[model samples]
Target chain A: SQTIHQWPATLVQPVGSPLSLECTVEGTSNPNLYWYRQAAGRGLQLLFYSVGIGQISSEVPQNLSASRPQDRQFILSSKKLLLSDSGFYLCAWGGTSGIYEQYFGPGTRLTVT
Target chain B: AQSVTQLDSHVSVSEGTPVLLRCNYSSSYSPSLFWYVQHPNKGLQLLLKYTSAATLVKGINGFEAEFKKSETSFHLTKPSAHMSDAAEYFCVVSDRGGGGADGLTFGKGTHLIIQP
Candidate 1:
């Protein structure tokens, strides 16, 4: 069985501070990773996705960026956080064959004050 | 371009009643559809997916959705609504071009409220 883990379950930061959220998947190799943001009561907004190491595609342009430093390690980072960046950040992973389902991590709730 | 629309923003149903949440999609290619449930303060969970397999896709927790290509709709339904079923449901469309782990477009979401 595969398991996804995320750190700093919740965080409170002042605006203009740096932000770093980590996601990792165990028991799977070369999996597809994604980062998404969900507002209070809205759908998910895709931020970035990684197909392989050092390869990332960003969907919406913003202050945040994502990196696949390792096969199973995906990090979402920002040099400076904005008030608008306050939301629930989620990480997901999927297989490479046929797409049917995606497994998600617990998620990081970041509040930029 | 592919997009999804969830017809309802909020649906209230009494426990033990039937549940129906409507969803319609627009896709260029043979699209894949999915239903996800998000509980408060919890990550999104995959309820079910439709990929040209069975038109009726059964998911966890006794949830199921029907894919109607003629209507371009994938409506989720449950014969009986449970109190635990109260949550936010999202209709999602995936980009087949994104491979298995590509991109998914989500609807605004329908909040399922259960009346005791």
Candidate 2:
């Protein structure tokens, strides 16, 4: 019964503009959250993950950053966006226990022009 | 370090034909493997996962995968291919004992094309 919500479903941003994408989960608490990006015709790339509030781990250095402001709320932000920052961003959550299966949100498609 | 390799970038099959997508993985320890599907413009959906409990795992939409430890491969199969099955498939691997903090490593993906 757990579900994740991400928005805005699609966005068009100008280069060098600020960016913010939000993801929230329901029916679970203290779950681990992750941020991933998929470029056109490329595989999913891990950007950041958080085990708890105020804790974030970066996998690959890029123009994006992630934050877990609440137990079930994760936000991906950038002070200034780059053309390379445009991609399909996904949010996922996994249980705190030994359960390793991750549930994904609908995702946000950003187009930086 | 754990990594996954999808042997094929594109696979075409006729409707009702058997479907197979090949995957291979490398891990230092016992690893957890998964297959995920992504529809165009949609998020990735987990189809199946292998955690060392069973070599053969069944997933949604009549899809199944077998884990061959000796070969270090987990290949996904289906009895019949459907038009709805046309999408991109990704093979993923994760370390089993590292507190599960390490995010999944994904394959480049295989594009499954269902021919009419």
Candidate 3:
């Protein structure tokens, strides 16, 4: 069975502070990883996706960035946090095959005060 | 471009009653549709998906959805609603050819309220 993990589960950051969220998948290799943010009214917005190591695609321009350091490890980072950057961030992984199904992690909640 | 619309922002249903969460999608070609549930402050968990193989797809937690191509709707249903079913539901659409690298478009989400 495949499982995804993300942390820190929750965080409180001051405005203009740095942000880092990590995601990893076990029992799978070369998985496609994605980052999504869910806000009150914005819904789930795709922030970044990775097809392989060192390859990241930005879906929307924002304060965040993503990196795939290893085949199963993905990181979402920001140099400075904004009030608008606070939301529930999710990490997902999908197989490298044709079907487009995705599995999500527990998520991280960042509260920028 | 692909998009999804969850018809109701909130739905209230009594326990043991039928559950209906409406969703419609727009895609230029054949699309892959999915239904995901989010518990408060948690990640989205997929309930079911339609990938062109089955018109009626059965998913986890006793939930099922029927794909209507003519209407471009994938509505989720359950025979009986449970208190545990109270959560936010999202409808998603994906381009059939892009795989997961293209990402998914999510609906605004419907807040399902289970009445006692």
**TM-scores for every predicted model:** 0.96, 0.97, 0.96
> Who is ahead in DockQ, 1 or 3?
3
Per-residue lDDT of model 3, residues B1-116, tens digit only: 78888999999999999999999999877888899999998888999988889899999999999999989999999999999999999998888564347657788999999999
Off by over 4 Å in 1: B97-101
Ranking by DockQ: 3, 2, 1
Q: Scoring only the second chain, what is candidate 3's TM-score? A: 0.95
Q: If both were scored by TM-score, which would come out higher, candidate 2 or candidate 3?
A: 2
Tell how far residue B113 is off in model 1, in angstroms: 0.1
Model 3: what is its DockQ? 0.76
Taken over the whole model, the C-alpha lDDT of each candidate is 0.90, 0.92, 0.90
Task: Please provide, for model 1 over A21-77, each residue's C-alpha lDDT reduced to its tens digit, 9 standing for 90 to 100.
Answer: 999999888999999999786788889999999999988999999999999999999
Candidate 3 chain A: minimum summed lDDT over ten consecutive residues — where?
A94-103
The model with the greatest DockQ is 3
* Candidate 2 residue runs with Cα over 4 Å from true position: none
* Count of clashing pairs, candidate 3: 0
Give model 2's docking category.
medium
User: Each candidate: how many clashes?
Assistant: 0, 0, 0
**Model 3 lDDT, residue B49, Cα:** 89
lDDT of 3 at B96: 56
Q: Which candidate comes out best when scored by lDDT?
A: 2
